[model samples]
Target: MNQLNYEEISTEFKNYFLNNYRNFIDEQIKEVKNSKFLINVSDYTSETIDEPHRIVTNFLKEKNIKNHRITNLYKTFEFEFDFYLLMLTFDERRKMDIELYEEIWRHNQKL
Candidate 1:
């Protein structure tokens, strides 16, 4: 397998996240709500927000995406959602990231 340069990885990461941002958030919200936890409690509140933030921020760090963008992307959900849903979102995002990386790699090769 060909190794990707830094710029290619960066572009692919940005494209993957920016393109799927809304769907990712929506899926997360759905997952949290579907978990059947009482969302009004303080513990639930902290878990819902903080856990996903940590999971997603860690994912971004692993992917070399800028951490600050997590705040820009994470908004207040009207309904509670599960933190585990972010894991599912991460899986999907990683797949897209791989595709984007390959696409960028192929495009770069043609030049």
Candidate 2:
């Protein structure tokens, strides 16, 4: 596609993340801390917090990122979610480095 066409899609995703997903993640983060797991924030609900993983996994997949096994359980959904949130945050203003954050995601996933 041309540059303009690409910008349109990019804008759409930008708005999508800003208007919805970002806030959703913020709430999820709190929920994850208070509770052991995430309650579905996005409409595209699945049993687990796979929504974040699915989106993150898809994005990475598109960029040709993959792994044979989930060598680190901590490296999946929670890491992806925090990373994405940081990305959006950076886009807006920037930052999720959080070892504790990763541990939380890893811990919950094991549950």
Every candidate's lDDT: 0.46, 0.44
Instruction: Name the 10 consecutive residues with the lowest summed lDDT in model 1.
Output: 76-85
The reply for model 1, stretches above 4 Å from the true place, is 1-19, 22-83
TM-score per model over all chains: 0.27, 0.32
* Candidate 1 residue-wise lDDT, 1-111, digit = tens: 444354554455445544556454455455544543433334334443454465556556676545232212356433312232354456655554444344434444554
Number of the top candidate by lDDT? Answer: 1
What TM-score quantifies how close candidate 2 is to the native fold? 0.32
Clashes of each: 3, 1
Best by TM-score: 2
- Cα error, residue 74 of model 2, in Å, equals 38
Residues 67-87, model 2: lDDT tens digits: 222224565443333364334
